[model samples]
Target: MQWRGRRQSSNIEDRRGSGGGFSGGRRGGGLRIPVKAGGGGIVTMLIVGAIAWFVFGINPLTLFGGDMGGQGSYQTSETGRAGGGVDSTPGETDNFVATVLADTETVWSTRFQEAGETYPEPTLVLFNDRVESACGIAGSATGPFYCPGDRKLYIDLTFFDQLESQLGAPGDFAQAYVVAHEVGHHIQNITGVLGKLNSARQSLPQDQANALSVRVELQADCYAGIWAHDTRAAGYVEPGDIDEALNAAFQIGDDTLQRRGQGTVVPDSFTHGTSAQRQEWFKRGYQSGNFGECDTLQGQL
Candidate 1:
């Protein structure tokens, strides 16, 4: 991973202590509460959290109560933001993420330039327990996600700890792979893949929709591999880094998660492909480093 002493991004919004609550406000100089669709308010979040936690055995605290640091309300103020009362703090982990983000920007910007297109870098939001996004309010339990609505990446660094202890995928490169996967989603959004998929999904049945989502997710994995390829070319990768990332891809696969969460595997319900498929597509992207080779939508899986 060797990410130390690298450049950190300034586009980070550090809200590690904003707590969990929803209110209406503008994004001022500090933490700004984002307004978007799909927010049903606190009561709705509670109901949704209970169902997800009790029934699915997933942690619901990330949905309702974010890290128990502050009050749970959906509003942001200059003083409300944590992390030294600024948008971003220069912590070690923060530096690591910012560096990874910068690397992605460099790789994609050059690639996009080669294609005669512009690459709009995405903002990465760092939160502790909960954060409001254009997609919806999310808790740390939601994991890292890319919201096309806002063109931002949301992540709670504690997820890295969970990745190590709970998911058993440890290492800096693995963490970078997570960031790259979300950035891959951003690439998809920019490339019109997401738009076309959204339009197509509107008329699709549930099973078919899930299948399309699997392709989308797998393609994101492949895109992550592309980032890895460029990263290695830039001399940032070390020995065992690729293996760490591959193991991470395996650990977070829908099949692995389902088998661990429940007792069975339902391929029809799979949305992110199996471990083998994930690893395969990632390897494909890393080996070829060609965007066209990463198309899982038109090609057979």
Candidate 2:
């Protein structure tokens, strides 16, 4: 990924050193999922963290005290760090993030214009340890997430360290995939797919809801691939960049995560698709670069 010297997004809200204290609880019913975790790798933490939010409608931090049995600890802000105050200056990592976001804005805006609609660009919030969102208060343990209520994507750049070390998916493009995937969710939100899924989930059984989640997540992966397609067309992608993203998609697949964490694969509990399925959907989008081709809902998977 050749992101240097590119335009950086002005939509970023830097709250890195600001303490994200708990206040009023979750304000609205919206879809929220953590993208990274500590013990048991990304998938294991996602399962636990998802239960904390999706099932119980509470903050994941409330349940982090239990043994997660993973290699790394959840990234958190220390007292000294939290009190140090926000750093307005953009660092190397921050610049990379902003550049990626700007690229997504350009791609999605073009896609929407083609359909005779306007794209509402989402704000990306950079936080440390914990952050308050309209959906709820989330600790870094919950990883990067998109809150539909506020239409913002929240991330702790430190999660990239865990992505490379704990999850074993490294590279600038892999990091870019994380941002693109969340923006994919933002795309779903604006297109009304997210709202419909949330409504349908309310009446469905657990297994069925999980299935819906898998489809939704896979579609986001496909959307990320679409962004990759546009980015490549714009002459930003270098050789091996696509492979790095594919590897990331594989690393976080529900089946792959379950196998690593529990030594078992339970299809019914899969909120994200299998590794093959994820890669397939992503390839579909990357190959076609069409939103119509990326539909995972009614199309054969």
Candidate 3:
């Protein structure tokens, strides 16, 4: 990945230094205090969380923005470093994110304009441990997610390191695919697909619900591919980038995650498509770059 000294995202809300402050642990025990859960998190954290859970075997400590899952309120302290967390230098991470986001903005804006609709740019927030959002409070553990309530994208950049180093998926395009996937969720929310899904999930069986969830995930993958296609047309993507994304899609398949989650894989419990299916759908979107081709619900699964 040739990502360095590139354009960084100005839309980012940096809060790495303002993590949940640490209070000294119990006497002689020295237990680390969990930075107040989801205080500083952004939408990207949800993506990190999901991918980390499905990809890496370990869970991250915090996320960047606040999400819809905020169970409790938290305020990131300017108080003191609980453990002197990594200083925020969003160079490569911020640059890659900005380019991808910029690409999405261009693609969606044009696509919507073609249909006589206006596309609203989504905000991306980068944080360290946890953050508060309109949806609710989320921690780094919450991963990268988009909250429909705020229309923002939250992420913990730390998750990127986890993705490449631990999760088995490496490369800038893989990270870009993750962002594109979350943005896809934001698109679904805006287009009313989420509303319909929420309604359907309430009345469906657990297995059926999982099936729909898988379709939703796969659609997001397709949308990510669509973004890639448009981005490539704009001279952003280079050789082998597509392979990184495809490998990511294949690596995080529902079957793979299920196998990791449970000793045995059960297709009925799958919330994301199998490896081959995901790769195929992503390729479909990438090759065609057509949103119409991403109709997973109406087309073959």
TM-score of each: 0.77, 0.78, 0.75
Q: What is candidate 3's lDDT per residue for 24-64, written digit by digit as tens?
A: 11111111225433333453454443553433111111112
Ranking of all candidate structures by their TM-score, best first:
2, 1, 3
TM-score quality measure for candidate 3? 0.75
Q: Summarize candidate 2's per-residue lDDT along 1-301 as a digit string, tens digits.
A: 7776788888887665533311211222222334444557566666444322221011112222222222111111122121121122446677778889999999999989999999999998887756777765666655677777778887767677666665667777888888898898889888888777777776789898778778888898899999999999999987777888898788777777677666888999877688898899888889899998878888322
Error of 2 at 295 (Å): 1.2
Pairs of residues at least 3 apart in sequence or in different chains that clash in candidate 1: 14-87, 20-72, 20-73, 21-72, 21-73, 21-74, 22-73, 22-74, 23-74, 23-75
Q: What are the lDDT figures for the candidates, one per model?
A: 0.67, 0.69, 0.63
Task: Output the number of the TM-score-best candidate.
Answer: 2
RMSD of each: 9.9, 9.2, 10.1
Candidate 1 ranges with C-alpha deviation above 4 Å:
18-90, 299-301
Candidate that scores best on lDDT: 2
Model 2 residue runs over 4 Å out of place are 18-90, 299-301
Cα-based RMSD of candidate 3: 10.1
Ranking by lDDT: 2, 1, 3
**96-132, model 1: which lDDT tens digit per residue?**
7778898999999999999898899998877765677
State the TM-score for model 2: 0.78
lDDT-superior candidate, 1 or 3 = 1
- In model 1, how large is the Cα lDDT of residue 211? 85
